[model samples]
Target: MGDHQIVENAPTRAWVLHPDIRNFGGSGDERPRDPARALEEAVSLAHALPGLEVVGNEVVRLPKPHPGLLFGTGKIEELKARLEANKIELVLIDGPVSPVQQRNLEKAWGVKLLDRTGLILEIFSDRAATREGVLQVEMAALSYQRTRLVRAWTHLERQRGGLGFVGGPGETQIEADRRAIDEQLVRLRRQLAKVVKTRDLHRKARAKVPYPIVALVGYTNAGKSTLFNRLTGAEVMAKDMLFATLDPTMRRVKLPEGGPEVILSDTVGFISDLPTELVAAFRATLEEVLAANLIVHVRDISHPESEEQAADVRAILASLGVVEDTPQIEVWNKIDLLADPTARLNAAARSDDIVALSAITGQGMDDFLTEVSHRLTGLRTEEDMTLTFAQGKQRAWLHEQGVVESEEQIDEGFALTVKWTETQKRRFAAL
Candidate 1:
């Protein structure tokens, strides 16, 4: 509500609930997430919001969601009594809740209610720092609010008088509010277009250089930011909380010898059932992953639901249109959390596409870096080229890339021997 509300002195008492559905009808072949782990994730999400004290959390097993209210009468009464006893000011549901259901539950429990989407939106609104990030979150929130206009505002039931020429009697307040939201969305889209154009120009400028982009992606709290900070030595916020890093961060990193320079990108973490509005709104920001030469998927190797979390991350990446050809490596992070040394060592030696490491304690970092360097070097190709005196820009670019091993001055121009990757060669050719 009102973008985000910040409480200064007192934190709001909140309770988290994760609805564990037994059967998903005829949906895709995806397995339902573990209930216990889902409850933990929900609690973490509640903790991510500032000034929210998560007093309690539980996994509520339901065969199917009730139409009028998400929970049955008995369950609702039980939870209402518990919430009253605990003095919870807010209830956070870890799954979708219909507008009618949400309203009914709120009335019954005598507290504010936030479904999964709303809670995620609040977190994004509070964490957004950059101008683009803020705009995207607002746009997404507006879109979500537009759909819930039926029960979102109390004034929606009021009718405004209008001239006979315009309408028979008048328009409802909800209609006017929807119109206003539409106008706001249009304005935001225009501003976002200009921002996107500027970002595209910046991307083109980066393309002139020979540095390859390596983007990190994974589920929330999977150690992507930690690994990014460790690799780039940047002070990006790296915490054990969900969605801690909302804005994408990029830094130029020099690889080991025989490896070309790379631009490392730390992106917002993905979560299971991320709102569709957010997915569409954040597409511009996620283009960094689309343009990447390599994607490193960081995973919390020690988590109980690590594989399930990995599946969720992969699903989101696929939804984002990540191509099959893009080289990907899975970093099994938080190996230090594993109690068994043999298991850690075995996980580290698993496969070519997998590298086990601990971003916090710096264990297995060398192996991770070595694998990255090896993969990047594998894309290199040596080439011989001649640049005429008229092609001063190309000559300068080749030299700037540090790819020119030898150069000779000819009568007409310069002859250079360059060992570069296919990407670098194409960029130089374009120049």
Candidate 2:
């Protein structure tokens, strides 16, 4: 994802720029995002990567972006002088940069260039702990690189282990590089399929267990891990950083007061402007959310852009085909960080659908738990289901759940009458 050449023990000096082109149609963001906040997020993304020390950052306001160089002559000269004065080695553009524009900018400014997608891919590659996660990141990076296979490999080859894809000479070299990337993608897909199959097996195993699955989802750094740890007492990496927990973690939690036992899943955080490649690559991992019986949407209510962040999360959820019928609870986490949390919480208390709490302090946790128990107590209905001769797993799962009241063997397979809650119905449908 990144190709910045750095000396040992020396962080790569990088400059961050967010091009605020006035007329530019916001890419995936349907509504306008605050430019200052957007740039702040960009800088945070830069900070998320380990080896880059950001020297300077700016919100470059423009009427429009230049297709050839992104910035105009005056702005280019201005930024170039700043880069040289600061001895910046890499320029991180906080938005999409066409390959031609990237090459021209690098040549003119005498610095290596990386865009938002590249930086994120680098961070994922660095932080991906699970084997599936690593494979997905590699596949996504390869796909991203396949399109931008035109940069000269002056120093990238020495830094990133012979990626050798970018900056090739001519049409022949570019075609060869693309073919190589395709081959790598094919290999990764096979590996990923096997991993996903294993994951699915685990999922089916969980379905047989007598516990409903609850998934926690929210924007990055929204305190999901903290809340999960509070509920389950698992030592997940909970830090004040974007993407502190990349891969999903699960724990079986026994509710207090003889409430229903459940499995709590903490998933990768959602972010605005997440690269499309990552969205597609991580879909398999995210299917857990779909299989969940309840979704707890944790939000950082103290942030000024909380509503916008929630909107982004919801948008992504909708894109993933999460139906509106799914049971959900909105959690306003980190109330301890709020100014006069009393009034803020009082306002939040107006809605039964929302719960405001401090995960670290354990405030309002009882109410949250009580609400979860209340939601999980869904009405059950009896229904008849039929299974084919080859569907032994499904038939066994239905019986294992203790929901089947009667079963009759038939020529096609078996017919059963079962009583179950909406959550169980959804889970069975998934199978």
Candidate 3:
């Protein structure tokens, strides 16, 4: 029955375990996250993958992780009994599990095991839609699989040699596996390079039209896609699920009250402890966020771990080398889901740098748009200049941009007052 269970139809019964390791020493800020919240996040991740029936979840407290087996022997036996009674087929560990630990745990429990990174990769594999997204996910999965090849093959100690004429020193099975993975990675990289080139051409074409970019970035399921749909009237898939929007989507949106039009970009949501393989593979896709003229960080204000999620997003942005001075706004989303009305009202009264809104309810959307317009307008520079009759090309360019607020013919030329952004000014200068 277990062997014949269909992943799409039968839905594997899964158990989630989050190890609350005491004195878990690591670099950086020392404050540890709440274990309960961490466990809740793991459960949510389990739900993110379709056809995974989360049968049970719990926090396994440990002074430290065991080297071979992640949990103590007694705890392992206890969980094994519980899994048998519940008929759980899969176990998901909410943190890193070494290959040795994973192999030992699966042997002891008589069930398949997956760690946080593995689960995330599976979710990405299921969610990726575009050709580039599929390629990137496959590359990342291959990279991750390469690391787990030790657990994958029992004949790693075997060796193979070439034909007599070409034979040198024989290669071990593990070396052959690693070489194959590396070759596949090279091929994928070549294909990805071509796709990226085409995407770059598209970006160049957009730059010619040259609307300022406003990118939405946030933790998974933080309502970024919802807000993007509200602003742009786009039909992008927005769900209360993690990683709902995998590939970045862009649409031209006119700001509130007939303000300037800007390109709104909805990017893949960030997560805490995102897989290193995925981060490297998706760098090309994330370049959109880096090029944005403005970044809107959406936060799920109703979630208990919102602050932690925001920190994760910021840390990732920093790793991506987002300029410190890049224009950004904090959007407190899902306010309608907040339990306290008074608190929600207070949140809505926050400063311009922060705006509270309910993307699902369309509340405070106008205010959010107003804030966006105000922020973008602040980046513009207005100046007056003189152009001679011979400078007809420049005059026409200014009119084309609709930045020529006022123009008057003078004795030897035309005096013009123009309002434009730095990018627009640079483009005109190039012209």
Candidate 4:
């Protein structure tokens, strides 16, 4: 929102491009995204924004990216002609573009440009509804803008001469702008720290209750909010749009048949090529996942890119440091959109792990709930410990967590039997 796009009276005509670079990353396991699917996703991203008409899109094959310009002079001229013919006012590139390349490309095509990171930032800025979410997005945008100051703002290169009585020379406009952004970032970080502290307090309060937290995480628009609403009956925005839910939403749900009472969290959906700036910005928003006792990796099994999307989610989870031992259930969601959902469900049922169902139709919800209860109840492990009189605090903590089952008076202080989760055990160890 800061410098991503300008407000216009009418829908701005936009075109999407995916630069398909060969041998990208060059690592042993690294490979470029599927060009066709990547282009489709870029188009979808463009469509998610308001007041913009994506007039056309293409996958531009690139042997290698040009340094000054992303595309070769020949391809640039060709695309420029196409954009001119279509009256495109904005160009959306489906990958990271260096600031220099961005400016040069915009100048070449005679249009405003937003690369993958910028486009995502714009959407996040527009969709962020919470105070913390807004501040995080603004900070991310500012951080991104700071890197592009010299390239994005030609006018900011102006130098102001200092008076003889003052310092020898005044700072350049770029220096002033970068300093201003840095100051704003510092202020935002202070505000965000306060907000995060409050959230941490809330999380701590929740921890005191013996309820396990189950987090819904997956590729964006994979029906996380819909599934959450189906489970908890909370009306979170469940649009089909990408990033429909930015801030994490949590609700406490009591499973049917007197099952365990647990907290259900619906988090921001993951996506392929998630911007680097956002990963750091939204860490607090996603810290809930770190606290989760169980994670439900929801996947839109009906989509062609389901496997790819699932991989992306896993990659992000790994990057976020989600422990491997945490119990996770793979939810093959949106089966209603599939052609033969029953067959697919049958295949999934054969596996003790995956649960295939449509969140909208409520199919197999009972199984899902039962699986969740089983997993949560199964998380408890029994142990025996002898606490000294000096350890009254830890003993009290265990009792408060409802984990101390039986205590016997002993020489040290008390010998106790406890049933608790790994998370609780870890907390006790920390204490």
By lDDT, the best candidate is: 4
Q: What does candidate 2's lDDT look like per residue over 183-209, in tens digits?
A: 989999999989988987887778767
TM-score for candidate 3: 0.84
lDDT of each structure?
0.85, 0.85, 0.84, 0.87
Candidate 2 regions off by >4 Å?
A: 1-6, 26-31, 152-168, 379-397, 400-419, 426-431
The local distance difference test score of model 2 is: 0.85
lDDT of 4 at 275: 79
Model 1 segments more than 4 A misplaced: 1-8, 25-30, 155-171, 256-259, 385-420, 423-431
Candidate 1 colliding pairs: none
Estimate the TM-score of every prediction: 0.85, 0.87, 0.84, 0.87
Candidate with more favorable, higher TM-score: 1 or 2: 2
Tens digit of lDDT per residue, candidate 1, span 1-431?
Answer: 35447666788999999988777554646677778988888899999999899999999988888889978899999999999999999999998888888878987987889999999999999998878899999999999888777666532222232323253324476799889999999999999889888988788778666677899999899999989999988989988789898887899999876677899999988888787877887776678998888899999988888888899889888988998777899999998888886776786586789998899999889888988998887876677778899999998877766677789999989988887777667788788
Q: How big is the positional error of residue 53 in model 2, measured in Å on the Cα after superposition? A: 1.6
Cα lDDT tens digits for candidate 3, 266-296: 9888888777877887766578898788999
Scored by Cα lDDT, where does model 1 land?
Answer: 0.85
Q: Which of 2 and 3 is the better model by TM-score?
A: 2
Regions of model 4 farther than 4 Å from truth: 1-9, 27-29, 155-171, 341-343, 381-386, 396-419, 426-431
